[model samples]
Target: MKTALFELADQVLFQNYGKRDLALVRGEGVYLYDDQGKRYLDFTAGIAVCNLGHAHPGVTDVIERQARQLLHVSNLFLIEGQVALAEKLTQLAQRGGEAYRAMFVNTGTEANEGALKLARRYQYVNGHAEKTRVVALPNSFHGRTMGSLSVTSNPKYREGMTPLVPGFEVAETYEQAVEMLDDRTAACIVEVVQGEAGVRPVDEDLLRRLAARAKELGALLIVDEVQTGVGRTGRFFGYEHFGLSPDIITMAKGLGNGIPVGAILAKQKVADAFTPGLHGSTFGGNPFAMAVANYVVEVVRDPGFLERVRQVGEALRTVLEAHFERVTGLGLMWGFDVEDAASWRKRAAERGLLVTVCGPKRIRLVPPLILEEAHVQEFEAIVTQMSRA
Candidate 1:
């Protein structure tokens, strides 16, 4: 069955991803069962999408119930689920009762695209028509779309996709970032934690300074919290840790706990820039995705659940620090430096563990929020055995 699936995939699917050998058949909690019935600890958590764990009862129930009711409806009509999710997101994003609005999409990249458009439009309508320049950090990953890719700094991803949308500049230093936020700057986008660049957290001081500078220069500060939001960084939004109140914030991974849902929460002034005909997504806030995301937001926003994530993160870091040479991350999002990450990942997979290698020599662990102490212990045992070997 695995071979057949692989063959079919090769024939029918795009050859974009580096296909893995094993074909997963089922999942329960933190474990995945392959076609041959082998249980593997899922540390990757579907690239951090399954925050509540695979087939979580609550998420599954929502999906099943919503599927039976309604799935997709064009964005022209009013959607109860979409409105509910947006209201929940706005409330969570702005705790101080600040006016905020949400625009939903189907993926992180779409959310970012929406954010970029919002920033540009805000600046344009607010009499800064020349503010079309965008600043991005050097090692940031926003998304794969052309608009988002233009701001992403990875040379590998941007190699062949040249002549990118103009007015995008990469800030090599904090000072450069300040200079880049001049009068022509539309927005400066940054990730709270650089996920694909090896899970490195952003410098708090630099971020704070940038925020101030952007505000002072009349450029919007766009926080790309696609990987760091949704309680992944022990906060409803990662920017909260840095005490930032960004003009626009983008989020996606884990927002639906496996359901495809992404959104951009923005201050009312900025959000209002996007008029009805200016920006729209055909299936952005579909009922099915919104229903699941509403449930995910309720569970992830709970104070107790977020606190548990913090505790588990600290415990996992302690265990990893004792074994690995270097560890870095916040909450459940972590990465460790290794001698040969690719080889290490292969060996770890052989031992029934799923992990992803980033950069050149870092292995990232973005496990489900439902991960327990026992799961961390099991991972520790695997690492200990591998270290000994």
Candidate 2:
């Protein structure tokens, strides 16, 4: 069955993704079963999307119930699940401050695209129409869409996509960022941790300074939490670690545990920039996605759950450091500076362990937030054996 599927995929599917040889059929807590029922402890968690682990009963129950009830309703009509999910997100994101508003989308890229639009619209409506330029950091990965891609600094992703969107600038250093934020700068978007760029976390002081400068220059600060949000970094949102009050926060990956859901949490003041018809998504906040996301948020927002994430993350790091050198990242999002990342990843897969490579020599591990010490120990045993080999 797996071989036939592979042959069919080769003929029918687009040749964009470099997928692994394994064709997984089912999943349960921290594990996946491929065709022929070979079990592998899943460490990637579908690239950190399954925070509660694959087929989480809580999330699955809601999905099944919601699917039986109502799946989708266009934005024209009011959706109960959509409104409830948005209210919950705003409540969690407020952090004891002013009210926040949420605009749901279908993916991380869409959330970022919405954020960019929100920032530019806010500047335009406030009579700062000249503030149309956007500033982003080098080694940033925003999205693949034209709008988000414009602000993404990696040349490989943008090589053939030009002539890309204009008014996008890349700042290589804090000094460069300060100079880039002028009267013409509408927004500055950055990831709290550059996930695709090898799980690098930005310095807190630099982040605070950048936020201050953007505010002083009348530019909106947008934090892209697509990978670090929803308790992936032991925080409801990654910006919390940096003490930032950003104008816009975008998220997606783990919001629905597996369901496709993305959102932009904007301060009420900035959210007012988007009026009736400024932006809209046909399937953004549909009922089924909202239902699953609501359950996910309820689980992730718990104090005990977040604390456990911190503990588990620290343990994972400790175990990895004992086996490898130069480990980087926070919480479940970790990367190891290895000598041969690709070959190491291939061997680990062969040994029934799954991991991924980032940048050139960084092996990234963005396991599910529901990971246990036992899972980490299993991975450790594999690494220890590899070290001897």
Candidate 3:
């Protein structure tokens, strides 16, 4: 039966998310409870944003304490939480003890947009005003905004939004992406793993070449870690797996566990282009978000915690490989090919397992970072039950 909430939502809300049937009213650990009080084993952790799992106690405590202490404050004055969080991020993001800086925003898209701007600003400020174009990879997903969208390659996203921000283009092929880097290019943005494109891993050799070519051509390399940062890939940043150095890194999902927050961590030399008056956000680095994110990083960046993620991720990958075809991904993130993806997801949901369909025959699993081996066994049983029918 359709709930009154759906009916009321139809009357009042925008229909951007398409037709919906499930309405989760509560969450704890890796489970979600619907309005009808049915329990579900969630494999999609809010599309990779809830890495610490739903309703994490540590995040809740930070939110409560921060809310009571101080919530909103303008960027006019110094924010201690932001400073502390930045220190942790720069430390975790250390590259041979090189200095790095960060700018916080509310979403991953914003982080990308800011990073792109920083790239161009760095070039322009250095007297290379002609270097304004950006090169993005094919099948990459950045954000919904204009600046980020310009570099995003999916035609479905840019269907009618022509005349996008000037000088931004997607290379037709990964090899061409390297060739496209030149004096006119401001930066080359890429994702370590194309999570939105069915959790496909980008070509490592091509990426290394891209980074090398961009550096040779005086263009910056930006790694968009939106879906892969904060332990989603069993590492603090997905780029760590590649062993390639990037000038700027954009991340948002899983940073605050649940609270909306994003940031751009760049090498100090490149980030310094954004002077005091260049860019600013009113609510980006507020104390509340800073506190929650600080707590999340402190927990996720622990060597023991990350090692656990790597071990469990390998176990989960084994289970997926055994049960499904073309299973690909790292850490807690994974994708597999199955017939009738929509129906398969529906069956899983009906059986109290939650998954997301990313393509016609692709289903993605981005379970919480804290997922245990027992959860994998539970997931196996559910899939086994569905496969029989």
How accurate locally, in lDDT, is each candidate? 0.90, 0.89, 0.92
Total clashes in model 2, counting residue pairs 3 or more apart in sequence or in different chains: 0
Give the C-alpha lDDT of model 1.
0.90
lDDT of 2 by residue, 1-389 (tens): 35888988888899888655888899999998888788888889889899999888888789889889998878999888878888888887887987999989999999999999899999999998899999998788999999999988888888889987789888887568767888899999999899898888988888888899999998999999999999989988988888898889899989988888999999999999999999999999999998899899999999999999999999999997887777878889998888889888888887888888886788999989998899989988888888888
TM-score per candidate? 0.98, 0.98, 0.99
Q: Evaluate model 2: give its TM-score.
A: 0.98
Q: Which candidate ranks first by TM-score, i.e. highest?
A: 3
What is the lDDT, from 0 to 100, of the residue 388 in candidate 3?
A: 91
lDDT of 3: 0.92
Off by over 4 Å in 2: none
lDDT (Cα) of model 2: 0.89
Provide the clashing-pair count of each candidate structure: 0, 0, 0
* Higher-ranked by lDDT: 1 or 3: 3
